[model samples]
Target: MSEKKSSLIPKSALTKAWLVWETFPQTCYNYERMMGQAVAQVFSCVIYYLYKNNPEKRKEAMKREIEFFNVHVEFGACIIGMAIALEEQKSEGKNIPGEFITNLKTSLMGPLAGMGDTIWQGVVIPILLAICIDLARSGNGNVWGAIIYTVLILAGAYALSYINFMFGYRAGSEAIMDFLEKGILNKLIKGASVMGCMVMGGLIVNYVSAVCGLEIVSSAQTYSIQTNFLDAVCPKILPLGATMLIYYLMSKKRWSSLKIIALIIVTGIVGGLTGILTY
Candidate 1:
């Protein structure tokens, strides 16, 4: 790519936009809208610039742009920059199809979210925070250590976000086309989904706790259901069963997360009160 083409958005404006997105993406998250409006707001300048002469087209574009969107904010900046570049080229009467952009965003968001969450939330932030918190809690009472660590984290995150945005804009539609042509995007999305499921399964088995309240009484001795049967069969049978039931509720019955959570909360409270669940 040429140097001029690489600088699609001016560096100043792009950096400012990245800061706004980083600071406020979650501020506008709603159940129905998620980050839809926040995303549209982030690229409002690009949208207006691209469709300035055509008010009707601008309205149409903005309308579609603010549809339900939810992605990890850090990596989502990349996709947003790519969208802006695509929109810019489209405004120039390029041969790009609208559905192509829409489908690309839809398909890429999940995988990108998984990758971003794994790197940032699952690993980096936690590890850094743990180490810094240890320093903060050290006997010296030096709050500056925590403050410096936080500033460094913020600076590093900003740099990463900027890099991702610029990379996406420079790569643009061609990169997406390459992924499609090679059939890699689908695999990426599927792999992320599978990995997310596996993680959830492991967490469920490792953390979910329950114990049997029943025991089999015999003439000679009493066989405890939890110690004798459950432990003998499988260690996490209750948790595994609970996880499977929730999965069935979601996959088969199409239950909403809120409803499922409510059900679990109620079940937990009642079970704890009734001594059915040993916790």
Candidate 2:
């Protein structure tokens, strides 16, 4: 029986991998390949490490990883990390079947993609955009807003990938996912969703605007139905309600984005024509 190795993937090797990791989303996107080439690009070093003395084995391993891969790019590190360990084992002639590598990746990427969506889109981008919107409120063409968002996004993206890579690298495989399935990832996602809701609420209040043009005149007085009635009752309720309606339609009813937007536009036009909506 072969003894298990105890050495870590070197920092320098990881740094090289990280460079490919950061750029793959932009450089390797394709309808057919879909980050498959990017996966090959990033993990080439790992395969090289495993087959440094065997050119034919290295070429086959390189070809192996290039098969179609699709996932939210943020989760690539974890997948790559797992691949690294397996490739290393294979290099040591540990008799790990090639099917195990491909099968695990195919099964694993789906969950990681879900997490990546929640983390990268639902939470990270929204929070950053909200912050940038705050800066743009200063009304100076939002140059600073652009600058800040760019810097923060780049930094955040790199940092996020780095942390996930390190964690996945250290954990070595699906063992971490076993712990993740016990509701840890779920709770984190839920907490992030709560925070995302708060930010989204703030965004709706600040960005979404709606008004009722209806007004009633009584003995030398006028009252706007929107400002006097709705706003007085619950500030910004129209925008808030509209936001919630869209949320319900999309989440519960499974409405498409285009369909929801069309509904809103159609409602606005009909309401404007019928005097239901006011400027």
Considering every candidate listed, which one attains the maximal TM-score?
2
List TM-scores for all candidates, in order.
0.64, 0.83
Stretches of candidate 2 off by over 4 Å are 1-11, 26-33, 245-279
Clashing pairs in 2: 213-278
The residue-by-residue lDDT of candidate 1 on 87-160, one tens digit each, is 77777887878777777778778877876776666556655665676678778887966897889888878888
C-alpha lDDT values of all predictions: 0.74, 0.77
Best by lDDT: 2
Least accurate 10 contiguous residues by lDDT in model 1: 1-10
TM-score of 2: 0.83
